[model samples]
Structures are given as structure tokens and as C-alpha cells.
Target chain A: AQSVTQLDSQVPVFEEAPVELRCNYSSSVSVYLFWYVQYPNQGLQLLLKYLSGSTLVKGINGFEAEFNKSQTSFHLRKPSVHISDTAEYFCAVSSFSGNTPLVFGKGTRLSVIA
Target chain B: GAGVSQSPSNKVTEKGKDVELRCDPISGHTALYWYRQSLGQGLEFLIYFQGNSAPDKSGLPSDRFSAERTGGSVSTLTIQRTQQEDSAVYLCASSDRDQPQHFGDGTRLSIL
Candidate 1:
């Protein structure tokens, strides 16, 4: 079984400020990591994923995340945030060995203040 | 190309009524999934269908929840004797084999 833990329930940042949303996972076996964003009243949109290779992954809207295997963490980061970036972010994990469904975190709500 | 599509963007009914939600996956995608999103439970997988294989129902909360994929394309989620706890946004997603799932807008079901 796989589980994801998003460290923050909510994060408020001023426009143009950098922000990081923390996430950690627990799994008995190797797993694939993913980050998704959901705007108000909309479904989740894939931000990025870490399957293999490089530890750092870049995603849309200038967002990026690094997969730290030793720490069991996949934290999302952005150099500068805009008011439009305010939304809910989720971290998910799936077993690397099979075609399995994703296990998601509770989510972190990012509020960018202008 | 069209993404996953779900019907009845919003639904409201009494606690005992049965409800059905629909989903149409993107053409050519072989995998489909159903999930529920509530206030505290961010996202919970309800079931998944891959090709003609039997769906995985391990995430379903109870027997009142059931889903079926017809003709290996469109899928329907049916909830019997809906309870207040069933009120949530029901989401549908689809993807190619080993690909990331593309999501639908989801149907917000409200039980009165």
C-alpha cells in the first residue's frame, strides 16, 4: 500500500514570493510520485511526475519539485508565485511495479496575496 | 482532443434516493478511474477499469457504491440508498496504459 502526506494544510504567500509545498510518502516498494493542482470548482490537473532518472522535475506554470529518495519527500516549489497561482495542490503515489491507482494526500491550499 | 467528460455537474436528492453519474473517457484511452473528493478526504479512488478486465473496487466505501464500464468506453457510477456521507464531488479520469490520468470536471452530489 502507498500513502502520501502533505505537510501543510494551507500556505499564504505574497505575490512574487517563493513558496514550497511539502510532501512525503510511505510505501513498501518503489513508487512513482506525482503533483496535481486543482483550481476552484475544477478537477485536478497534472503538474508533474517523477518516474525515474533525475531527482529534480519541472512542471507547468514555472513549478518544480525534487524527489528525495532518502528522505521520502517530493516537495513542490516555485520561484515566484502570482495571485493566479492560488489553488489546491495534491501529492500522489503509485506503485512502480504495476498498473495501480494513485494514493493522494489531503492537499495543501495555496493562497497568493496581491 | 477532448478530455474526460462527466455529466450532471451538480446533483441534489434526498438521503434515500439512488443516483447515477456518467463519464465518457477520451477516445483511444484504455484505462478509466473513479474517485471521490470530500472536505477532509482530499481524493479517494473508488474504482478503476483497464480494458476488458474486471474493475478494482477495493477503495469503495461500502456496498452502496458500484460502478460499471459499458462497451469499454463510457462508465457509470451508481449509488444506492444514498446517505449524507455520500455527498461529495465524484470525479472520473482516463488514460492510456501507464500514462497519467486526465480528469473530468466532476459531479458534485449533494444529499439532503
Candidate 2:
């Protein structure tokens, strides 16, 4: 079984400032990583995913995450955030094989203040 | 092309009542998934359907929760004897093999 942990429950940042949402995972076998964002009253949207290849993966809305094998982490980062970026973020893990259901963290609420 | 579609954006049901939520996946998507999002919480997997067959239904909370997919296109999740704790958003997602899943707006279920 795989599990995800989002270290921060909430983070407030000024607009145009950089922000990082930390995530960690535990899985005995290989796994894939993903970040999802959800706006108020909406379903989740994929921000990015790390299946294989480059350790650093870029996602929509100027967000990126670096997959660290040693740390067992995939922290989402944005150089500059906008007010529109305020949303709940989730970190998820899936099996390396396709069609597996995702295991998600509790989630982090990002508040971008102007 | 249409994305995933969930019917009855909001559903309110009384305790001990049965509620059904429907989902229509994108055209040509082979994989469909059901997940639940409780207030202020992350999504919990409920079931997974590959075509018309569900290979993984382990995530279902209990026997009261049941789901079925038909023709590999539409799915329905039914909760028998709804409880206040059953209040949450039920989301449906679909994807091609090995691709990122696309989600629908979800059905907000409120059990009173």
C-alpha cells in the first residue's frame, strides 16, 4: 500500500511571491506522483505528475515539482503566485502500473494574498 | 468533445434514504474511477472500472455503498441508508490507459 503526506495544512503567501507545498510518500515498490488543484466548488484538476524521466516536472499555472528519490518527496513550487492561485492542493501516489487508483494526502490550502 | 459528466450537481437526501449518483465518462476512455471528497478532506477512492468490469472495489466504505458501470460509458454509485457522515462530494474521473485522469464537477451529496 502507498500513502501520501502533505506537511502543511495551510499556507498564506503574498501575490508574486514564491511558494512551496511540501509532500512526502511511503511505498515499498515504485510509484508515480501527482499534484492536483481544486478551486471552490469544483472538481480537482491535475497540476502535474511524475511518472518517469526528469526529476523536475513542470505543470500548469507556473507550478513545478521536483521528484527526490532519496527524500521520498515531490514538493510543488511556484516562482510567483497570483490571487487566482488560491485553492486546495493535493498530493497523490499511484502504482507504477497503469489504471491503479490514486492514494491522496489530506491536502493543503493555499491562500494567495494581494 | 465533452469531458466527464456527473448528473445532479447537488443531491440532498434524508437519513435512511437511498441516493444514486451518475457519471458519464469521456468518449473512448477505458478507465473510470469513483472518489469521495468529504468537507475539508482529501479524496478517498471508492472504486475503479476498466471498461464494464470493476477490478477494484476495495475502497468502498461498506456494503451499503455500491457502484456499477454499464457499456463501459456510464456509472452509478448508490448509497443505501445515507448518513450525515455520507455528506460529501462524489467525483468521477476518466482516462486513457497510462494517462492523466480528467474529472467532472462532481455531485455534492448532503445527507440530513
TM, chain A, every candidate: 0.97, 0.98
Docking class of 1: medium
Native contacts kept (model 2): 0.67
lDDT of 2 by residue, B2-92 (tens): 8899988999889999999999999999999999999666689999999999999999999999999999899999999999889999999
| Candidate 2 colliding pairs | none
Per-prediction CA RMSD (Å): 1.2, 1.1
DockQ, candidate 1, comes to 0.62
- On the 0 to 100 scale, the lDDT of residue B47 in model 1 is 94
Q: Per-prediction DockQ scores?
A: 0.62, 0.70
Name the top lDDT candidate.
2
The TM-score values for the models, in the order shown, are: 0.97, 0.97
At residue A72, what lDDT does model 2 achieve?
100
